[model samples]
Target: MVIGLWLASLLLALLTLLPLWRFEAWWVRGLDFPRLQLAVLAVVIVVLQLLFTDLTQFNQWSMLLISSGCLLFQLWWILPYTPLFSKEVMATAADSTSPCIAILNSNVLGPNRNAQALIDLVKQHQPDILVTLESNSWWQQQLDQLSDSYPHSVKCPLDNLYGMHVYSRLPLHNASLQFLVEEGVPSIHAEAELTDGSRIAVHFLHPAPPSPSENYSSEERDAELLVVASSVKDVTTPVIVAGDLNDVAWSETTRLFRKISGLLDPRIGRGMFNSFHADYPFMRWPLDHIFHSSHFTLQQLQRLPSIGSDHFPMLVRLCYTGRQQPQDGVDPDQDDKQLAQDKMMAQAVAPDQVHRPETQAVP
Candidate 1:
């Protein structure tokens, strides 16, 4: 009986550590909100080990290993969500009369039949731009009326989870859909012309999640995001990148992407907008994200209501106020770290030169 109890305690401890070791891997595959669960289990396992000390000789040592592992993983995993370590860039000055642009990003599950709920939500919000992921021909047909309102659009209706569609009320300039990670998995890159003539480059992406059904590892996804970040770094125009990144806000790869891209996340002082797994509130994390260049100020950030999809929509309003003056304090090593990430991105893309797909213009 004592041996069985000891084994059970140890097993629980190991189970808790498993999440810590695989948080990034699980998150990239869209299994969001594992961090909090892992933390809770770790504490419970430690208590169990302490209470059952009489059953095992090395109970304290096992508990220490479990505790240390959980804490270390949490620290490493949570760094991206903490804004103190992230750099903030202000948007370039634009005319005060320009309209505030609002974008709604939604990953409507492909198999979900409730298109009316999503259509109603979009109609209610009246966002300037609406991007939907996992949309098929059926989903596209349901939203046909939207084209009349949007005027400018991009549509890639695929049966795979990669299916993407974008609708813009504003003029879409030089819009092109490219596959950054895998063939046919589209990433929409375009420029939205504001009424005041200021152009903001937008990149919409939905990379494959890391899972047994999908890719076995997250290296491809991480490498793809890093590549996109690198592409945005050199652009002088105002930039905004949004989509289902398949990564949590707290992961190391996400932090590195933000640093390399020189983008700002509105969630800094604000709370995490955990957007995925709407069916299970307790098992949700901020998988979808909105990132903009320093040239813009956040006017509003909100998580829209669920519309029969597994993921909820995110609506963000950004105003193109003139770029503020750079603060005097600059981290000497910051640029170096960014440079390293740039190098990694370059290397990752170099090997796949043959696989690069031709960019298709949005009609």
Candidate 2:
């Protein structure tokens, strides 16, 4: 029993620490999703080890300390998203506010037939804009009920599972599809005209994820995001980049994205609104994201209930202050800029690395 406990502790500790290396392989990047889970499991292993093992021995004490150390490392990253840390997006000091835009971001899981669930939420929330991912032609057809309500829309229906649809009650100008890395994969970009006649530049994406059955490395996903991040820097108007980012909120890639784009996440200092794996509570992380520039303040951020997809939808309302507020997100260094440049430069997106949505090992 002592030997068994020590082995489990050692293996668990190694798994927890594997993500420290900046490797893009799917397994390593996948490890990035389960940090909270890993931290919880580490606690369990530590408890069992203390109860069953002889701590005076060299090997036993060493394994216990190593596992405890790993648990702390995971917590360091996870704590920022909790109330224990400072909030990234705070309420504005001014009582008089600019126009507010409510956005609902959902990955409708192409094959999932329960369209009414999402539609019902859309009707209830009445968001200013709605972004749907994994939305194929059928999903798009099912969602046609929204056209009368959302006259301004952009539709990119694809069977590849990277399809995206944007329905907005607000007027959208220069709304076009952009192929950042992969040809079939598309991202939506537009300038949303608010009721106050101010425009907030919006970028919506559903990038291909890193998975054993999909892209083996996160290079393409990372590169595609960096391409968008690089563009956000050029826009003078208040910008918002929101969608199913396919990366966790705490990963190095997402951190780099936040830094490069100068966008703040409302989730920080609030909670990890783990949006993915809605069916399985044990294996869930924040895949759906809504990020905006510092000029906006968060009014509401909520993780809506499941819509029969692997991911639950995210609803966020932001009050655009019409002028620049303090920037609370991470700042981009020269190295960060150079790294984003390199990722975009190397985006000769490998053909084999890209896979269809139907091929994903969806549970």
Candidate 3:
């Protein structure tokens, strides 16, 4: 029994430490998804080692110390998302006089048949903007019903799972699809004019995930996100970067993205609001996200009901007011900028990817 427990401790310790090394290997980076689960197990082991085992033993001492440290680190990273910590983005009343922009970001699995569920969500929430990832031609046809409600739009209905579509009630200017890091993968960039005549830049992305079947490493995903971060760093306009980031809120890449781009995650004080793995409640993490600028205060950040996809839709209602006080932002240091630049340069671009996808105005 002691040997078996020791083996488990060693395995857990290794898994907990793997993501800290900045390894791009899919298996290593994949460890970032289960910090909560691992922390729970680590604490249990620590308790067992302390109460039931002989801590004087060298192996027992090592196990207890390692497990306790892992638990502390994991909790430190996730504590911000819990209600116990202060909110990173300030919240305001949803019905305030300031112009509110509610955005619903959904990754409607390309073949999922429950289109009405998503449609119902959109109708019920009536978000000013709707961004859908993994949408194909068939999904586009199904989502056409939304056009009557969201007249202004952009669509890239590729058969590839990377397909994306954006529908907005507000007028969108210079909306274009950009293939940032990988061929055939596209991200959307646009300026949305809010009701108060103020414009905020919105960048929607769904980069490929690192997996055995997908991209072998997270290089392309990290590069695409960082490249966007680099582009948005200097913009004076209010910005909203929202979509299925295919990354967790606490991942190093995401933290780096926030630091470099100077974006704020509404979920910091809100909740984990896990949006992916809708089918498996036990194996889930937040993959869908909406990171915005300090120009807007969060009115509501909620996880909408699942729409028969692996990912549940996220509703972020933000109030845009020029008077909203600037919140604390992460200033990227030289090392962060250098790391981002290196990742961007590492992603190999194809010949046709040199130009942005032609701007297609949705009628």
TM-score of each: 0.78, 0.92, 0.93
lDDT of each: 0.72, 0.85, 0.85
TM-score of 2: 0.92
lDDT agreement of model 1 with the native: 0.72
- Candidate 3 lDDT by residue in tens digits, 70-143: 88989988888789878889888646788889999999999888989999999999999999999999888988
Which residue runs does candidate 3 get wrong by more than 4 Å?
A: 56-59, 93-95, 348-363
Displacement of the residue 146 alpha carbon in candidate 3, Å:
1.7
Model 1: CA > 4 A from native? 1-33, 46-69, 72-76, 79-98, 324-363
**Which scores higher on TM-score, 1 or 3?**
3
Q: Show pairs that collide, candidate 1.
A: 89-294, 90-294, 90-295, 91-294, 91-295, 91-296, 92-295, 92-323, 93-322, 93-323
User: Which residue runs of candidate 2 sit more than 4 Å off their true CA positions?
Assistant: 92-96, 348-363
Looking at model 2, report the run of 10 residues with the lowest lDDT sum.
Answer: 351-360
Candidate number of the best TM-score: 3
Q: For candidate 1, lDDT tens digit of each residue in 188-264?
A: 98888777866778889898877878877676677678788766665566778899998888655677777767777
Q: Per the 3 Å backbone cut-off, how many clashing residue pairs does candidate 1 have?
A: 10
Candidates 1 and 3 compared: the better one by lDDT is 3
CA RMSD, predictions in order: 5.5, 6.4, 3.2
